[model samples]
Target chain A: MALDKRFIGREYGPFVYTIGAEKLREFTLAIGGAVPGAGTPGEPLPHVSPLLHDAQAAKAGPYGDVIAFPSFAVVFAIRPFSAALSDPEMGIDIQRVVHGEQELEFLDVMRPGDVMTSTGRIADIYEKARMGFVVVTTESRNQHGKVVVTGTWTGVVRG
Target chain B: MPRTFQTGDTFTHVRECDRYRPIYYAGASGDFNPIHIDPEAAKAVGLGGNILQGLCTLGWAVEAVGVFVGDPGRVRRVRVRFSKPVRPEDTITFQGKVTAIQDGRLTAEISATNQRGEDVLKGAVVEASLE
Candidate 1:
């Protein structure tokens, strides 16, 4: 099925996610990263943080106690992605679907245990050559609406 | 005082995923797409082998940049284009270097290549100082 162009610019939903530190460790370990120690200046660091690095500030996630992996922010807005892609009205075929690209921007560091929400939107829909490109952007923020991260996914639909 | 920066300096790291690495990332990320996890599922279509998830490969490139910047928050922007899929038995390398520096922001051109030197992802990133 070809991607539904009508869904372009339509915001799907606000998906909530509760991230943890252990899951970060699991990802790092699985990817062959060693647990990192601390972020002290001039000190060599590990792949996983022993404790939250920016824990001093008044943070929303996890009381700023648990640490977050470097790439952990990707999941912050994934639930909204699930909802957007699974919409029946969208004709995205799960098989022919291939992830073409991803760009993530971190505005602020989010620690584990932070309660946050991800708002998703179909940012762009276009057809180039014989393939279709669907770009989806999701924004994750704290209860206070402080932007934590922005994740954009570009999927290529080849029929 | 902050250290002087130049655009000519760069870093590159080469790596390859094991036969099982892709599936592990999929499980962790809760993206149970069979194209990346199941070899047979991939072959049923037109893929030569089970391809790595673009996110997993992105995570790897992110790891490379994360180490270079020394802080997770230092990364301001990252753009990646998956030119080809990364198979399990293939070795991939990430090559990147500073492309531009302006007003405390640094831009980098990055790419991941398989064992056959097939470009997996062509991308760029902009990083900023955390201080």
Candidate 2:
């Protein structure tokens, strides 16, 4: 079944996510953003090799606390976006979909401990040569109701 | 001091995703799609093997911009199309060329290619503050 064009304007929930430091640190390390040494600066472990050079200044550098990577918003927004797109009511098949593109606009930096509420919407739907495309956009706002980031995910579902 | 960028300025950064990159990205990004984390499942689906998350590749491009701007927050906007699937152990090279720089903002045309010279990302554009 093709993705329903009528669901283009459908909106999803305002899911709340309280950012955690451990998650941030994990993402940082996963993206190779950890401070050059084996451990954070000022509190280096004695067991770490002293020959380790400061490759990327993660800890003792700028961005005081752990900050989310540019694409980290996906962790917070994917669930709600998935729920919105995979709804049986939407008549969409999740198994045949492939990510086509992405756009992210960072309005403000997201730090650990910040609480954010994310809302997802189907921005557009189009079909081409037996394939269906759905553009999902998510807007995440901070505790103060300030927009922190906006991400657009484009999924192409093969017919 | 803010760095001044001129049109045509170019820089490139490369990142090689290890065999476990997809799994780590799946865990970190919460995108556990079979094609991204399970090799067998990926092959069954015709993907040959587990592939890296598109967002993770985008993160590398963002990191390149961060290195150029000296701050990640300066990246105001990033747009890119995932032209090809990035498999594990694929070395992605992110290249950028300054297309515009005005009013304390810089815009660049970016592209990424795999070690095999295949275009993994196309029509990529990033706008960042010149701080």
Residue A91 in candidate 1 has what lDDT? 61
Model 2: docking quality category: medium
Clashes of each: 6, 0
Candidate No. with top DockQ: 2
Q: Where's the lowest-lDDT run of ten residues in candidate 2 chain A?
A: A44-53
Computed on alpha carbons, the lDDT of every model, listed in order, comes to 0.68, 0.77
Interface RMSD for candidate number 1? 3.4
Which docking band does candidate 1 fall into? acceptable
Model 1, A68-125: lDDT tens per residue? 5546777656666656666667866677778887887877766566778888898888
